[model samples]
Target: MPKQAMENLTESMFYVLMALQRGDACGAEITAYAAQVSGGAVRLGPATLYTLLARFEKEGFLTDAGTVGCKRYYRLTAAGKAAYEGERARLQRCLDDAARAEITAPASLTKGDARDETARQGNRLPSGSLPVL
Candidate 1:
């Protein structure tokens, strides 16, 4: 079966959009900025960077700012900025959920302990409850 297309931004896509947040950048500059901003955690290869650039441009999320000799500069359009912000908000929610879960969970319970408890309870609605449509 064919893999379904991603509906949300991937980590690399998020970083690439972020790299263009400050201003227009060439492919190499975007990669460098992504690495620098991520504190060396995210690195974009040449192929992946260019491919994203092309896709973003085609999607109307980015615009060609200009070209300098062999390098072409790209900047985020309004849609791109919105997409970046949306991804940022989604990531923040994930972090917040993890933090809240950690704080509320008993210290003695290992990560697996919580899962085991839920499994023991069974994956079912309460006896008198009807599933929401």
Candidate 2:
């Protein structure tokens, strides 16, 4: 819930935040949607997922919109959505720059995986070497 905690968010936290970016959702629904959107690569367990949700709610990044049955629904607050958008944009640039490099490269390099994709390319610095604007 603290600023430092928010800044140090994990990938699962990011996925949950991204899932709630578009609309409100209950806990189970949020998890389901996140898994679907991520092509089943990221699955959020109940404890870890809800803890992050609670922290985000406390941080003012999310709004608790009450419950349906046993499910607690949440909507991203304006701040939460903005953070998600910022992360999304940053990730987009990473993808775009990597693609451009691959296209213009003299030879093929490692494909996929952010670290591998952005690893130093023959003395060329990584795109994310500088702070994202």
Candidate 3:
């Protein structure tokens, strides 16, 4: 399969893509679910989320199915699904690599080793010294 362009996606865009992977959802529900899933780490404020959603919609990553009030419901297009899965896999590998680098580093390395590695990768360590996403 052709690889998807997931590396260009922002964190919120990535989370929103993953949120739509399982099923369709309106804006509010998507934000709520993403926030819950990320344990409030990935905040999808209205302006940011909807704006990205609009871009994703335009880019054929998501499709508008219907709306309730001002809220628009969306489902992932085939491309969107593929992108989401690809991005999820990429994120998983990043997390795995970070964890492995931290664990397997020499004993002389301290907590700063793990924290610095996480920072170098532009990722924050998840709560309890774990990766969140």
| Candidates' C-alpha lDDT | 0.86, 0.80, 0.84
Every model's TM-score: 0.75, 0.69, 0.69
Residue clash pairs of candidate 1: none
lDDT of 2 by residue, 1-133 (tens): 4465566457798899988876888888888888999899889999988899988888999998888888888989988987787777777898999999888864333454344454554454666775232
Cα deviation at 69, candidate 1, in Å, is 1.3
Q: For model 2, where is the 10-residue window of minimal lDDT?
A: 107-116
Ranking by TM-score: 1, 2, 3
As a whole number from 0 to 100, the lDDT of residue 41 in candidate 1 is 96
All candidates in order of lDDT, best leading: 1, 3, 2
Candidate 1: tens digits of C-alpha lDDT, residues 1-133: 7644334798899999998999999999999999999999999999998898899998888999999999999989999999889778888999999999888877545566544665588965567975432
> Pairs clashing in candidate 3?
none
Model 3: residues with Cα > 4 Å off, grouped in runs: 1-6, 106-133
By the TM-score metric, which is better: model 2 or model 3?
Answer: 2
Error of 3 at 84 (Å): 1.0
